[model samples]
Target: MKPAVTPAPPAKDARRPPYAGYAMAAIGAALFASKGIIIKLAYAEGIDAETTLALRMILSLPFYLVIGIHALVHTRARGEALPDGRLVLRTIGVGLIGYWTSSYLDFKGLEYISAHFERLILFTYPLFVVLFGAAFFRQPVRSKALLAFAVSYAGLALLFVQNMAASGSATGTGALYVLSAAVTFALYQLLAKPLIMRIGPQLFTCVAMGAAGVAVIFHFLATHPFEAIFVSPTLWGICLALAFGATVLPSFFLSAALKQISAQANATIGMLSPVVTILLAMAVLGDTVSGSEWLGAALVILGIGWFTLSERKG
Candidate 1:
């Protein structure tokens, strides 16, 4: 070594992080959209909703528990106070309602609907977020937001026309279940947002996911047999995919993406999710969309995209 030359400092990043952020968001959304498709596939294997959900939670539990432990160790090293009892209880409650309850309804809904329909219905959550924010958080609802809701829902209603035409399908009931899931999920976001601000999202999510995992376990014990978990190999694959690929990994990716970009941009770019779901549903599940249904999907995407970005600007 010539005169103990100091190693050159690491090069600074010149490329803005938004490129990676957008890619992560898009990939995360696609992975998330795959949840419905995977759920449908598992249903075809004749797994009940309770057992199916429990399997997913059980498989995903390790990821959350590990994160939770990491949080604890990190906090201790930093001499930070641990979350108080109130915060812990609040997180548990949010986890129950948001993940357990919402996922229960969603899986039940998937029993009766195509993945395509399920995705379209779930995409309506932004509208519920607006309403919930206005009603509970006292956030002022602007005209543009309302207009966005109207346009999106009008598109959804047009899809309902497709259901109406194809009578005898369980579309009505499925739509209700999925819509309930979206509302509860929105509520979870609203309630957890403040707590997330107080305690970091990593810690909050770890706690919340652990709570939801416990709930699913209890539900499984109450409603399913012990032997039920040792089912067909394909079902196990689906559960693993949902737990890791769709749930845990993409969740982290979405969180990391948020760190790089604003939530507005994340949501705006996430409009691609339904498109991903649509393509998967069509290709993998052989589901078809009519012209009117395609129009409805477009309207939903455009409306929510507009609403999120516009609200951010305002």
Candidate 2:
């Protein structure tokens, strides 16, 4: 008699647990938040923004290369077909635009603006997050979320004014540049989320970083003298820290977290990053942000909390 047929094993579920996702996101945020403090140190040592970007990418290249190579190996071992060239090309294009351009713009803005206020506007990524969610995911924005976004943006406005005053800039021109950086960053994050979904976060990030790194290296060669990179050990140290801490660690953790959480949740957690950045700046750099900035941060946090806790109708 024929033996009874055994049922096939159930398929693996790719969806990650919510708590795990949120935790990874928090870790990513912490790593990213620390970037400002490191950059300030690098700047103090006379490493200009372009050089910093190049060096950071240079330092980060190995880590991403390992991940990318591993991805290729794993796919080959599993006998799975290669990923589509079109997808890779798309990632390369978006990565160049998002990672390289956005990073340069942010560093440029930071030169003319306070890190804390740059973070404040940067936190406005949630606005773009929601828009992306609505447009791509077809997520219905609940009223509470709308309210939260409004409150947070208001806080951003306050921080903007404070940043201008702190910089002693004329007519808030510096703030406009900061705002422009924010807008570009929002676009990048939104573009990245979907791409990360298609390619596993680690593989996706590795490739993206590779794309960005290549672009930056070319730009560095074209525009600036190579002498800036060899200036001093202190510069090298800061650049290494920026790579390991700011780019590599944060990108990996954030991508891992994205596996579990929606883009909106990621954006919400991102709001906390600037607050952490501000505290670190004060502690490390002896920089002073006004009371209004503090108040604005508090409001932004509260708004984010309210949005997270509120229920949405089906």
| Model 2, global lDDT | 0.77
lDDT of 2 at 8: 80
Task: Provide the global lDDT of candidate 1 against the true structure.
Answer: 0.87
Would you list the clashing residue pairs of candidate 2? none
Runs in model 1 lying further than 4 Å from the true structure = 1-17, 167-169
Candidate 2 residue-wise lDDT, 157-226, digit = tens: 7776776565566326645665666666667777777777777666787788899999998888888887
Candidate 1 RMSD computed on C-alpha atoms after optimal superposition onto the true structure: 5.0
Q: How close is each model in CA RMSD to the real structure?
A: 5.0, 5.7
Q: What TM-score should be assigned to candidate 2?
A: 0.81
